[model samples]
Target: MESPRVEMISNSFVKPKFISKEAKKPVYLSPWDLAMMSTHYIQKGLLYALPKNQDFSITAFLDDLKDSLSATLTHFHPLAARLSTVKQQNPPSFSVFIDPNNSPGARFIHSSVNLTVADILTPTDVPLVVQSFFDHHKAISHEGHELSLLSVQVTELVDGIFIGCSVNHMVADGSSFWHFFNSWSEVFRSNTISRPPVIKRWVPPGSDPIITLPFTREDQFIERPSPSCLRVRNFHFSSDSLVKLKAKANSECNTTKISTLQSLTALVWRCMTRARRLLPDQETSCRMAADNRKRLSPPLPETYFGTSLHSVKATATTGQLLDQSVGWAAWRLHQAVVNHDDKVIREFVNSWLKRPFVYTMSRYFDASCVHIGGSPRFDMYGNKFRLGKGLAVLSGYANKFDGKVTVYPGREGGGSIDLEICMLSKNMEAFESDMEFMSVVNEEDNKLRIF
Candidate 1:
C-alpha cells in the first residue's frame, strides 16, 4: 500500500525570453478573476506513454522542455508576472504584470516516482500518489503575487512521463487553462505556437477595470482543513448513453430540447440529491460557469486569454426535483443556462462590484448543493507533445471537496463525456449504489470503468 514515493530531482524557475511593454503595465483583474481569489490553485496533469523502442534520456528531455517553456512564456507574460496590489489609487486595486525587474519566472520542477503508468491508471479511483505530481497543493490563488503564477512539474514514471501544471484560478478558468496547455504542447512539438494568447485582461466596458476585495489578509482566502472524508471517482458516460439520455429528455420536455450537457447535469444532480437523502422540502441547487466568449455584445474570441465566465445556478426543492421526470429537471437547468445572457452577465458583475462577494468553501459543503466545474468541450487528449499517440491521460487534482464536480472530454474523442465527481465517502458509496444513476453509467466493462 505504501510502495510508491515521489523523489524530487530538481526545482527551478524558467523566465520568459522577452516581455513586451504591454505586459509591463498592470493587467487588471475583472470581477470574474476576483471571484476566484478565494479558491484553490487549478491543478491539471497530462501523462504520455514512453515508446518501447527508444532509450530516453530524462536529462535531455528536461532541457528541451525548459527551452520550449521559456519561449512560451514570452507570449504568456502574465503567467510570468506578479500578483500586484496598487494602493496608489483611491480604492486599492489588484493586477498581474511583469515588473521585469522583480519577475519570479514560472516554476519548473522535475521529479521521479517508482510507479508505472498502469499503477496510476489501473485503479477505479485516483491513487494518493498521483496528487504528488502537482505543485502548490495547499496554496490559494490569493498568494499569486507571492508565488509562481504558473508551475509545471515533469514526473518520470516507470513507463511514461507526466506533466503536471498548477495555475492560479484567479488568472484562468478551465478554458483559458487548456489554452495555455495547448500552446505549450505546440511550442514543445514545433518551435511555433499556432494560437498565441491574447493576454490583455477583459473587463466589460463601463465596468471598473480594477477590483478591491473586502478582506485584505491571506487567512481570509486560504483553504481550511476539512474533517469530511471525501471520495472522488470519474464516471465515463459513453456517447451512446448521451444520445439516449438526450432523446429521453427531449421527449419529456415540450418547451425546448435539452442539450447533451444539460441532460447529463440533470441526471447527476437528481441522483446526487436522492442519494443525499434530503428532506422533501429541503432546498437543493446546482451551478455551472457559463462561457461568455460568444455571449457578450461584442463577442470575445474563443482564444481570448484569462477568465471570462459567470456563475449561474438552478434551484428547486428536493421534492420537486425528485418527483419530476429527468427531462423536467434538465429543463430547469437549461433555463438557468440559456437565460444567463449579456444583460445577466453584466448585471451580476456590477452587483458583485458593489458587494465584492467571494466564494467560500463552506458554500459548496452543503449536502443539497452541487458545484459543477469544467466542460467536456475542453480538448484534454490533444497534448501530443510530438508523439503521435497524444496524451495517455489527463486529470484534475488538489481542489476536491464534498459536492465538487468536474467534467472532461472522454479519451475516445467522440461525443463521450466523463464526470469527475467528489463527495463525502459515505455519500459517494450511496451514490455509486444508486441503480438509476448506474443505468447511464454502468461499470459493465473495463474500457468504461478504467482509463
Candidate 2:
C-alpha cells in the first residue's frame, strides 16, 4: 500500500475554489514570533524523485511559494512580522531574520545535495550525520536579544545536489504546513493551483459588550526551566499491540470510564518503573495534553488559533502505580482527565506568569515537566511518515504549543505512533529498551504475571 505523499486537501473531498476564507480575528502571531516557532516544527526539506516530468521546475515552484506567502502576510499579526534571535554560542535557536525591514515571513529556500541511493540507505555515518545536525541546532539559545532558527539542507546523492529551505511555524501548524506543501505539490504536478489557501485568524475571547479578556492577573507565568529525572523515549508497537491495548482498555473499565491513551500510558509507567526496580518506592506521574477543541466549554471556534489545549496529569506513588492492577491505574488517569477543563488550563497559564519576575525565574523551576501520551493525532494523514535524515522527534512536548509535548501521528495511517523516545545520546538505548518492554507488557495478558 502506498503512503499518502500527495492527497486531496480540504475538510471533505471536494476541491475548493475562490480565495479560502479564514475567520477574521487578531489572535494570530506577529511575523517575528512565527519565524522563531517555525524552526521547531519545520521538517527538513524532503528529498524525493518524481517522474522526471517536463513541468517540474524548482525555481518556479519557489516563486509560487513566495507569491503565496506575500499574499498571506497581511493577514498575520504585525508582531509575527519580527524575527527570532539567539546568542552566538547557544544551540541553534529558532531562526530570526536580522533585517527587520525585510518584511515579515520569509519564503522557504530550496537547495540540493548529491548522494547515491545506496549511500542514503546504508551509509555507516548516517547516525553521526543525524546527531551532528541536531547538535548544531542545539546551540540556538538567545542571549540578550539575539534569535536564530535553523536553516535546513538536503543532499540528494542521486541528483548530486542539495536543497535548502526554511519554514516558519507561526504562519502554519503541522496541518497548515502540510496544507501548504500539498498545494505546492499540486502546482508542481498540474502547473495550476486548483485551490489557494484560505487564511483566517480565529481569536478566542471574542469581543464582548463588557470588557473581558481571556486571561486575568493569574493567567500566565514565565519561569526558568529546572532539572528533571523524568525520562522521555519513543518506540513503535506492532499493530497487534495497539489492537490489544484498545481491547484491554475497554474491558478494564467495564466500559464505564477509560480510554486507549490513558490505558497505555498507565501501563507504560508501571512497566518502566518495574525495570528500574524503583516501582515500589518512587512517586511517578503521567502527563498528557487533551485537545480542547471539543473539550472546552462553549467550545472555541475551529477558526480560533493559538494555544487550545492544556496538560492533564495522572499520578501514583511508585507502589500504588506498580502494585495496583493496570486497570486501576488507567482509572486514575481517566479520572484526572475527566476532571480537566479549560478553566484548569487557564489557571495554569495564568499562574505560570503570575509574578512579574516569575517569567525570568526559569532558573528556579523544577520537576514540572509533562510526558504526553500518544494518540491518533500523530497519524498526520492516516499514513505513517518514515523518518528522514536530520529529523528529531517531530512532535515531542516542549514549552511551546500548549507547553506540552504533542504525540499525534504525522498523518493518518502515516504509520502507527512511533513511540520513539528521544534523550541525551547516552540514554537513548535505555529509553528505547524500556519502551520495547512496555509495548510487550501491554500486548500480552499474561505478561504481567512475570513481575
Candidate 3:
C-alpha cells in the first residue's frame, strides 16, 4: 500500500512565554535520565473530533495551542532547552545537561493531510500515514542536541485534528511525558498548571550526584537495531471483559488478587507466545517498566520531571505459561511488579554507577520477549484540550518493534484499557486468529473507531 502524503503548511518554534531565573542554569541529567539515551522519542497522538458549529476557526485554534504550549514550557524549562554533552579527557567520562540559557523552545508544526478522521479511526490497524503526523518518529533521544526535545505537530484532517507530540525519552519517562501533556492541556483550557513539575534531579546516596555518561556519541553508546516488518494494532479490553479475567485469575490463585493490568499482560504474553509457535521448552519473557517515584526513601515528588524507571521481567518456559492457568501467568507478573521496590531499585542504580549498562531495547534475550511501554494508569482520555471530553482515538508512533505493547486507558474509562500490540505480520495474523485470545477481548471495542 502507498503511504499517504503530508503537506507542509507551516513550521515554527514555540518559545516559553515566561522564563524563570532558574531557566538560566543547566539541569543535570541523572544517571536514570541518561539511561534512555539510545531509545527513540515517545511519540503519541490525541485525535479530536470537530464540532458541527461553523463558528470554530482552525486558525484561532492553532494559535491557541501555540499560546498554551508556550505557557506550558515556562514550567517545563527542560523541554525548551537543548541536551548538551561536554567533551572530556580520553576514556574517562562525559557529562550531559540542558542548555537552559539558549532556549530555542519546542518545535511546532502546522500541517494538513488529505485524510478524514474516519480514514484513521475506522481502520482495523493504524495507518502508516499516522507515523508522519509525529516529528522525530525515527530519531533517538540522544539526538536532542540538534533538535527540539519536544515536538508538536497539529495535523488538520477533513473532520478532525491530531495533536501529535514526540518527546525525548532520555529527558523523561512515561509518567513525566503524560504529566507534561496534561499540564499543557491544563494551561490551554485554564492558563494555569494545578500541580507544578518538580524539576530537581535525584541520585543514589554515597554516589556522585553529577553522573557522567559512559560514551559521547550514540554509536559509541550502542548500535541501532535494524527496522523489522512489524504490524502494530490495538486490542481494547472492556471493563466487563477485564472483570471476567480478573475474577478467573483470582479464583485460581491465593488470598491476594492480581491487578487488571497484570491480568491483561498475562493474556497478551501467553497469547503472543502461542501465536509465535515456539517450542514448549522455549523461554518467553515479559519486561515491564516500574515507576520508582513513590518507592524511594525520601520519595521523589509525584510530579518529579525526569525518568525514574526500572525494568522488571517475568520469565517462563512456553510450556509453563501455556499449560498453566491464565491466573498462574498473572501471578508471576504480579510477583514481579510487587517485588520491584526501593531496595531492588537502589541495587540496580549502584550496579549502574559501578559499570553503566544501558538496557538496550535492541537486545531480545528470550526466544520471544515482549516489552510493555506506557501505562493504563495515565489519564489518556482526560487530555481534553476542550475540543472534547473523550478521545476519538489515542495512538502512538516510534520505537515500535516486534513484541512491543503500549497500554492506554480506554475512552469509556471505568477500568477499560487498550493495548497497542506490535508483532510481525505472520505472528499478528496468527494472534488475530487465536480463538482463546479473541474470545476474551470485547469485539465491540477492538476497532480503532470514534468512542
Global lDDT scores for all candidate models: 0.80, 0.39, 0.83
Q: What is the C-alpha RMSD, rounded to one decimal, of candidate 1? A: 2.3
Best by TM-score: 3
Ranking by TM-score: 3, 1, 2
lDDT tens readout by residue for model 1, 303-343? 88888877779999999999999999899889998898888
The number of clashing residue pairs in each candidate reads: 0, 96, 0
Cα-based lDDT at residue 417, candidate 1: 85
User: Which candidate number has the best lDDT?
Assistant: 3
Clashing pairs in 3: none
Q: What's each prediction's TM-score?
A: 0.93, 0.59, 0.96
Model 3, residue 374: distance off in Å is: 1.4
lDDT of 2 by residue, 1-451 (tens): 3211211111111111122233222233322222232123344233233224567555554445445433433232221233333223333222222223333233233333233333332321122232221212322112112322222333333432223223333444444444444444444344454444444333334322111222222223222233233344334444456557767766766774676667666666565445544435556776765655566667655433333444477767778876677778778888888888767655554443232122222332122223653355532331111112222233212232211233543211322444433333343344345753555533332222110
Worst 10 residues of 2 by lDDT: 6-15
Which model, 2 or 3, shows the larger TM-score?
3
Minimum summed lDDT over a 10-residue window in model 3 is located at: 358-367
TM-score of 1: 0.93
